[model samples]
Target: DTSAFIMELPAYHLPYAMTVLKYALDRAFSFVKRAGTIIFAMNVLIWFTSNYNWTLAHVDASQSILADVGKVVAVIFAPLGFGEWRATV
Candidate 1:
């Protein structure tokens, strides 16, 4: 059996420095904006879960829903390495 492969390449050219810089800055800003929004949302979720109980009443971090779930997951991950509830969360 034989196989044939053909490839085509475009001519090499130097990119305009200003255009490249502007493009990089634009992409960086876009990524930062998206990441900031997601991070903010996650912080809010973590705060809510770590401070509230199933009944929605504020509680100590150790007694919150996040802690409960973390403890359960900690047990499952114990043999793999560090499995402390705090670490799991």
Candidate 2:
């Protein structure tokens, strides 16, 4: 029914809808780009941290790099009511 209504909209509305859709798509794409940037940063950081121990040498997994960073982030988010970093990371 929603699609039917959209399809039946007058010719004049087509341009409006197109413009709105274009704006919406542009905004959505910007969001995707930002999200991608954040994900890329996190992945690289996490990988670097997990793979290398302090002094830049191999070590155990639990005492890895990501743990420290994740703990900090978890505390930051704690005030928002989601204190657990396990699920976040």
Candidate 3:
């Protein structure tokens, strides 16, 4: 299949320095906000999973739900090396 398109265009001119800076800063801040929120959420999840058992009781890391899940994953990774539950996690 083939297609052709036509478009009108405005003449190009250099952008204002302040306008470019502002646009860059706005995009940077937006990215930082999204990345920060995701990191914060992941940290919270890791903390919760590593500190609580399936019953929700506070527990040591080795006894937490994360450890149980990691053990299962560790088995899958065993043939590839680094099979320890802690390493898997």
Candidate 4:
């Protein structure tokens, strides 16, 4: 197993291997603990971008916040040949 290799059970001192394992486990557990918060924040951003238009009205998808943002970005890149707002979106 990867954990076994990382711990080096037979090669390294038990305390050192355990210290490494503890660090790895702490990082993994922290990610798991923070996963829900991260997903919730991303979903809120996506929802805001997808549901609201430039005028802040709940309009059609084409007029959503993301589309407006894309159009603005596309203008900056238009001279570089990326002209289609939809493509930029």
Candidate 5:
């Protein structure tokens, strides 16, 4: 079966695989840190533009509203720290 074929792969290969992955990830993170600022700025700009549209459409325009929206999105996407971890602390 295919499972037996997969099982034949070396268990010792994991350390080597992880070492290569770590280096690749380090380089990827460095590239992102150098180049991702522009992407982050663009996303913030888009958020502001969408908010402006909502304002023009007679939605409530308040700092608290936007702050809450940002918080909700952050909670949903980055829930690990902002959710159970923070709640227990």
Candidate 6:
């Protein structure tokens, strides 16, 4: 009876699994897009500040902040293939 009941089950339940997988993939793509935008903004900001001229003392302080931000952003966005993005700017 157990074998007969198992055999009676529907053979086509894959659509449900495919739907769930598609939903998960969509969420992951959205997350990557958001992360890319954030990394782009940070890179632009760093480039802007680094190019701005200031007094020697102020420039030193500003450089430190920029460097720290670069390191943090690098670590956060490493998995997104942004190593060149960080280095280029």
Q: What tens digits encode model 3's per-residue C-alpha lDDT throughout 1-85?
A: 2335656689999999999999999999999999999999999999999999999999999999899999999999999896899
Q: Write the per-residue lDDT of candidate 5 for residues 26-60, one digit (tens) a residue.
A: 99999999789989998886466445543444243
lDDT score, candidate 6: 0.65
Give candidate 2 regions above 4 Å deviation.
1-15, 67-89
Q: Give Cα-based local distance difference scores for all models.
A: 0.93, 0.76, 0.95, 0.82, 0.59, 0.65
lDDT of 2 by residue, 1-89 (tens): 56655645455634578889999999999999999999999989878887777778776655666666667788878887767655445
Give the worst 10-residue stretch by lDDT in candidate 3: 1-10
Candidates ranked, most accurate by lDDT first: 3, 1, 4, 2, 6, 5
lDDT of predicted model 2? 0.76
TM-score top scorer: 3
List ranges where model 4 is wrong by over 4 Å: 1-19, 32-39, 79-81, 86-89
Evaluate residue 1 in candidate 2 and report its C-alpha lDDT on the 0 to 100 scale. Answer: 54
Q: On TM-score, who's better, 1 or 3?
A: 3
Compose the digit string of candidate 6's lDDT tens values, residues 1-89.
56655645557645688899999999999999999999999988766566544432345523545555666677767787765334523
- The model with the greater lDDT, 2 or 3, is 3
How much is the lDDT of residue 10 in candidate 3? 92
Instruction: State residue 24's C-alpha deviation in candidate 6, in Å.
Output: 0.9
Q: Write the per-residue lDDT of candidate 4 for residues 1-89, one digit (tens) a residue.
A: 56655643456545688889999999999998799789999999978887898678898767899887888999988988888676676
Q: Is candidate 2 or 4 superior in lDDT? A: 4
For lDDT, the strongest prediction is 3
TM-score of each predicted structure versus truth: 0.78, 0.53, 0.83, 0.54, 0.31, 0.41
Candidate 1's C-alpha runs over 4 A off are 1-12
After superposition, the stretches of candidate 3 with alpha carbons farther than 4 Å from their true spots are 1-10
